[model samples]
Target: MVTRALIESVLTRARERSRLLTDSVDDGDLVAQHSPLMSPLVWDLAHIGNQEELWLVRDVGGREPVRVDIDALYDAFEHPRSTRPQLPLMDPAQARAYVRTVREKVWDVLDGHPLAGSPLAENGFAFGMIAQHEQQHDETMLATHQLRSGDAVLVAPETPDLGGTPEIDTEVVVPGGEFVMGTSVEPWALDNERPAHAVDVPSFGIDTFPVTNERYLAFMDDGGYERRELWSERGWSHRREAELAAPQFWEWDGKSWWRRRFGTMEPVRLREPVVHVSYFEAEAFARWAGKRLPTESEWEKAARWDPRSGRSRRYPWGDEDPDDTRANLGQRHLGPAVAGAYPAGASGLGVHQLIGDVWEWTSSDFLPYPGFSAFPYREYSDVFFGGDYKVLRGGSFGTDAVACRGTFRNWDHPIRRQIFSGFRCARDVQGEQA
Candidate 1:
C-alpha cells in the first residue's frame, strides 16, 4: 500500500540523485553538451523539475505553475542535444532555484492529499514516476560524465571480486511452457509492461551469465568484426561506417587491449560482463559463436518463469528488492561485476545476472502488448515502438531500484553502444542439455 512515508522517501531519493549529478560539476559543465548525443546536464536538471511540475503539481494536484517560460527550453524532443547549448538556457543558480521551488510546492501537495482515487495519485504512482524519471536522468548525466573529457568528478570504491570458476554447464535449459510475459500486479511498472499476457516459449538454452570480455575478445581475435559473413546487412554497414573493432571505449595497443573508463585507462577485466556493446555487436558475436540471440519472450521466460511454483517472480532472485549482495545496482559500482558474480541473484533455472550488471539486448523489436493503452503520455513508450528499435532487458549499475524490476523494459536503437548495454546468447534446447 502507498503511504505518506513512502511518498516522502521517494521524493527525497529523487532529490538526492539529482543533487549527485548537479553538485559534482561546475556551472559551465552543466550547460555545455559533453556529447552531441546527450542533452546538456543543466537541461536534464531543469527538465527533471519541469516533469515533476507537469505531473505532480499541474496534473495531479491541479496547482498553478511557478514558471512557464522555461518549459520550452526543457522540452526534450523540441531541440536536439547538439543544438541545446545555443539556446538561452538558465544559469546554474536559476536552475537550482527552479527545481527547489518545484520540489517545495510538490511536497506541499503530497502532504495535503490522501493520494488516492485518481490513477496518477493511486498507489503513489505519480510520485514513483517522478522518482524514476529523476533517477533515469541522473543515469543519463553519468553517461555524459563518461563522454566528458575531464578527470573523473565522481568516484566509488571498486566492486569486489565475486570470484568463481566459470561453469562448464554455462547455459540453463528453460522448459517449454506458458508463462506470463508482463505484469498486472506490480503497481510501479510502466504502461508498456502492463496487462500481463501469457506467452508459450519453446524450450531454450540461455547462457548462465552474461557474455564476458574474455569471450568477446576471442570473437574479435577470430576476425568477427572484419568478416562480413558474421553480420547482418545493416550491422555490417554500421561496422564499416564506425570502424568498430571491439566494444566502444576499447582499444588494442599492439600487444594487448586497454579500455578507457571514467577518464582513466586500464587493462580490460576479462571476467566482467562485456559492456558498452551494441545490439548489432551482440548479434554478430552470437552469429560468430554459432548461436542466436533470445527472442523477447524467451528471455523473459528464462528470467522470471518459476517452473516449480508456476508463477513469475518479481526478479530472478525472487520478489525482494535488490540489495548490495543481491545485485550490483544504484551506481554502487561504476561498472559490471564479473560474469560469474551474484550467484544468489540467479533465476530459478540458474540464469545469472538477470537483474543488473548490464542491460541484455534481445532479438526482438520494441512492440506494444496485446492490450496496449497509452497511459498518461504516449511519448514514454508508444512513439518508439517499431522494428527500428531493439529491446534491452535487465538493468545496470547506474539503475536505481525504484526504476528497475523484473517486468521493467528498456529499448534503444540497435546501434547504441554508450549507455551500459550487454547481452548473452541463447539457442533452442536439444533434449535437456544446453
Candidate 2:
C-alpha cells in the first residue's frame, strides 16, 4: 500500500492547500506563531519538504542530502512560532516550484529502494507519519487563514431542507458492556489509536447532535464568560488570564452578529454547529447548559449504533465510503454544512452527524489506554499526552475523509479555537446522578 504514488498524492494535496493562504509583501512578518500548533506558511512549506527528505532519504541513508542546508533551512522548533524565519524567503511561485522539486526527488528515491525489507529502518512508519503530519498542517493552515484574513468559507448543504433537530424527547441510551476501545491494525493509524483493548462502559445517554451556534449564543447572551461558577478551575483561569471572549471568528455587530469564515464574511447561522471552539469553550458551554461532555469511549460506542441493524457498524453510516450526500468533508462544500445535513452518517442509536461536520470535544484528556506501547516514531503519542491536551471525536469540515475513520483519535489544547471544532453534550447512566 505504501507507494510513491500515494506519497505524491499526499504531497500534492498538502501543497495545494498551503497555497490557499495569500501572503503579501505588505503583510509584515510572514511568520505567525512559533508553537507546534501551526507553522508559518513559509516555514511550513520548507519544513514539511525538508522533513520528508530528512526521514525518508537522509535518515534512511545515514547521511544528509548533498545540497540542502538541513540545519539552517529547516530548524523551526528552535525559534518561536510567532517569529518569521530569516532564512531565504520565497514568493509563492518560487516556493511552490521548489516544493515540487523536493517532492519528486524524495518520491523517486523512496520508490527505487526496497524499504519493506527492514521494519526497524522505519521507512514505512516515517512515510505515513510525515504524510499525515502534512495533512494536519493543511487543516491548521485553513484555520489560521480564517483567523488572520477573516476569510474562511462556511458552506450551505447541497440539498437544503434536510430537517434541523429531530423531535426526540430524550438522549439515545447506550447499554453498558465490554467494548473494544482503541484501534487494532489498519492501512494507516496513528500511534495513539493503538493497543486496542476491552473496557467496561456503564450505560449512558448522549445528545443526538453537536452543540449549535444558536445554542452557544444563548450562553454568551447569559454572560457565560462573566459567570465563573459554570467554568472548571482551569477553564476559569484560562478565561481570566487569556481574557477570552466569543469563539475566534465571532463578531458582535451591535444589533446582530457575524462571523469571519474562509476569507469571507457571512451572517452567523444559528442552527449550524458552533465551529472554532476550544475544549475549554465547549466544556463551559455544556456546563452553562446544565449538561456534560462525553468521554471518548462513550462517543465511540454511541457512534457505532446502526438504527437499521440494531447492531454496531464500523462507521456512523455503516462500513461504506463517505459520499458527498452523507457528510460535509473533503472541502466539497468549501466549509461546514448544517449539523443535521448528514442523517445517513448517524450511529445506530440515531446519533446524527457523528463522523464529519465538526470534530466534537470529549471530556477525557489525551491518554494511552492499558497495554500501551510506542510505535516506530516514539514522539507520536507519548510526547503529546503530558501536555494539556484534550481528545476530540468525529471529524471537522477540513479533515481528510480518509483520515477520519470512526476509531481514529484526535487531540489538541483546550485553549485553541482556530480549528473547525465543536461539541455535543452527554449524561451519565444515572441521569446526572453520577
Candidate 3:
C-alpha cells in the first residue's frame, strides 16, 4: 500500500523535474516549437497544470474549476502538437504561476481526500497518476530540447563509468514458456497494461545489451542503407522517401560521423546504444545481422521472467524502483550509458540494460491484451491500439521511474525517428519449439 508521505514525495519529485527541465531553457525557447512532432514547452507546462487541476483538485476533491476558461486550450485531444503553437498559450511566467496555483490546490485535495474507497483514489492512484503524467511530459519536453537547434541549454553529469566496459557475453538464451505479460496490481499502471495475462513464448536468443553504435556502424558500412532486400516493402519505401542514411541528427564530415545532442556536436560514441532510429531502421539492421527484432512477449520474458521461481519481476533488477546505479534514467545523463555498463541491473536471464537506456523497439504491433478494458477514458490507450503503431518496450534515458516499468508500453509510427529509440536482435533457438 502507498502512504500519503510517499505520494507527497513522488508528487514533489515530479514537479521538481518539470521545473528543472523547463527552467533550463530561456522564455523564448519555451514558447518556440522545437519540432512539429512535439508541443511548445510552455504548452506542456500549462497542460501539466491543467491535467492536475482536472483530475485531482476538481474531480477528486469536489472543488471548483481552476481557470476553466483555458481548459479547451490545454486539452490535448482538442489540439495536435503541430497546432499547439497557434493557440493562445500561457507564457513562461504565466505558465509557472498557473502551475504553482494548481499545485497548491492539489495539495489541499491530497490532504482532505481519503486514499481509499474509490478506484481513482485507492492507494493514492489518482495522485500517482498525476505524478506519472507530469513525469511523462517532462520526458517529452526533454525530447523537444533535443530537437531544438541552438547552443547547449542543458547540462548533466556523465553516467558513472564502471571502471571500464565489462567483458560480458554478447547474447543470452531465454528458455521461455508461460510468463505473466502485464500488471493488474500496479496502482499507477495505465489502461493498456491492465489485466495481467499469461503468454506462451518459444525459447529465443536475445542480445545481452541494446545494439550499440559500433554494431550499427558495421551495418551501415556494409551498404545497409543501399540494400533494399534487407528492408520490408513499406520500410524501404519510407527509407527512400525520407532519405534516412543515418540516425536522426547525424552528420558525416569529410572523415567521420558526428551527432548533435541538445545543441552540442560530438563524435558518435560507438559504445553507447544507438538512438533516434525508426522501427524500419531497427528492422533493417536486425535483418542485416541475420536476426529479427524480438516480439513483445519475447522482450518481456527476457526482461521480467525468472525461470527458477516461475514468476515475473516488477523490473529487470526486481520490484525496487530505479536509481542511478541501476539504469541511466530520469535525464541524469544527456545520452545513454555505454553498452554493458549496468551489470547490476541485469535480468534473471542476464539481459543487461533492459529497463532503461533507449527504448527498444519490438516486432509486435500495439494491441490490447485479452480482457482489456478502458478505464476512466478511452483516448489514453483505446484510440492507438492497432497496427498503425509498433510497440516499444523498456524506457529511454529521458524516461522517469514513475512512468516506466516492466509492463509499461510505448508505441509510435514506424517512420518516427525523432524519439529516443533503439533495438536489440533476437533469433529462435535452434532445435527448440517456439
Candidate 4:
C-alpha cells in the first residue's frame, strides 16, 4: 500500500539540506543564477514540493487546490532554468511554508488512498513523473551543494567507528542460465528498466564488498592512470583528454592522500569505499586488479536470493530500508561508510554494501532488455544505449531510499566523475569460461 512516509521523508531531507546552504539570501536569490545546471535553490525547493502535491493530490486524487496561484508560483515551463532570473521569486519563509502546505495536502491525498498502488492507480504516469523528476532535482541539489561550497572535488565522508568484523571471504557462483531481467510486475520503473525479458550469462564470482579506498589506491599507486594498457580504447582517450591522474578529489599530499568532501578538506580514509569515480575508472581499476565487472544480469542474480533455497530478498541484504548499522545512505554521516561496514546488507553470496554506500559500476552497456518498450517519459532510457554509456547500481550517500532499489539502473559516460560512484569486481571461477 502507498504511504506518505517516503514522500514526507524526502521533503524533510530536502529542507534540511537546503538549510545547510551558507547563503542566507532570501527569495530574491531563487531566480538568480548559481550555476549552469542549477536554478535558484529556493525556487527548486518550492517547485519540487509543489510538484509532489500537484501529482499526488491534484492530478492523482482528482482534487484541486483552492489557490490556483501554485500553477504560476511553481510553473516550470514558462519559468525554465534558462529564464529563472526573470521570474519573480518567493521569500524563503514563504517558499518553506508553501512546501509544508503542499506536503500536507499530498499526505492527505495519500492517506485517503491507503491502498493506492503505484502511480498508475492514482495519477497514472504523473506520480512516477514527479518521483523521477524530484530525483533528478535531488541530483542537482547535490551538485549545487558542491558548487556553492566551492568544493568541485568532494571526498567521501569519514566512516564512523562501527565495530563490525568483515564477513570472511565468501563467494557465490551463479551457474550460467537464462532468467528474466527488468521489472516483471508493473512498477514505477524508469523507461530504461522496462520491457523485461530473459537473458543468459556465464557463471562468475563477485566480491562481497565494494572496492575500498585502500584497494583502489593500489591501482593508483601502480600508475593505473598512466598505464594505458588497463583502459579501454574509449576510456584511454577520455583519460588522456581529462588529463587523468587519480580520483577527482584525491591528491598526493607528499605524506599521505587527502580528499575534499562537502566543502571541507580531509585526509583520505583507507578503509572507506572509493567514491567519485566513473565507469571507466572502475573498469580500469578492475582490469588492473585482474578482475572484471559483473554484468547487470550477473549482479542481480547474485543480489536476489530465492526463499525456496533460503536466499534473501531481492536487495543485496534483504527487503528492508537502510539504517545506521547497514548501508550508508540518507546522509547518515553525510558520506560513505567503510567498504565493509555493513555485513547485514550483504547478499546471500556474502556480497556486502551492494545496495548503498556508493553506486557500483557494471560491465553491461545501458541497453534495454528484449521486447523493450518505452515508458511514459521516453527520454529516460531510449536516449541512452550503446552510445558509450554504462550501468551503475546501488545508491550513494546523498540518495534517498525511494531511489535505492536493486533493479534501479543509473547510466553515465565512461569518463565523467562528478558523482559519488564506486564499483565492485567480478571474475569467472577458475574453471569457468570467460
Q: What is each predicted model's overall lDDT from 0 to 1? A: 0.87, 0.71, 0.90, 0.69
lDDT tens string, model 4, 1-434?
33456545554565555554414443444445666646777778777777776666776777876346766867766566767655666767777777677767766766666435554554334554566667656666665665454434333455664636564334456666665566655345566666666666667888767788888878988999999899999889988888878787777888898887757778887778888888888999989988899888888777764423643354666666567676777655656787567766766666677777788889888887777777654555786777888888888877766566667788877776777788889888756642
Sorting all predicted structures by lDDT, with the top scorer first, yields 3, 1, 2, 4
Each candidate structure's count of clashing pairs = 0, 17, 0, 4
RMSD in order of candidates: 1.4, 3.9, 1.4, 4.5
Worst 10 residues of 2 by lDDT: 21-30
Q: Which residue segments of model 1 deviate by more than 4 Å?
A: none
Candidate 1: worst-modelled 10 consecutive residues by lDDT: 160-169
Q: How close is candidate 2 to the true structure, as a TM-score?
A: 0.85
Q: Any idea what lDDT model 2 has? A: 0.71
lDDT of 3: 0.90
Candidate 2: tens digits of C-alpha lDDT, residues 213-331: 87888899999988998899999999999888888777888977887775676788877888888888888888887788999999988886444455445677787767776777755
Q: Could you tell me how far off, in angstroms, the CA of residue 297 lies in candidate 1 after the best superposition?
A: 1.1
TM-score of each: 0.97, 0.85, 0.98, 0.80
Q: How far in Å is the alpha carbon of 47 misplaced in model 4? A: 4.2
Off by over 4 Å in 4: 4-40, 63-101, 111-119, 122-136, 150-158, 161-172, 186-188, 307-312, 385-388, 430-434
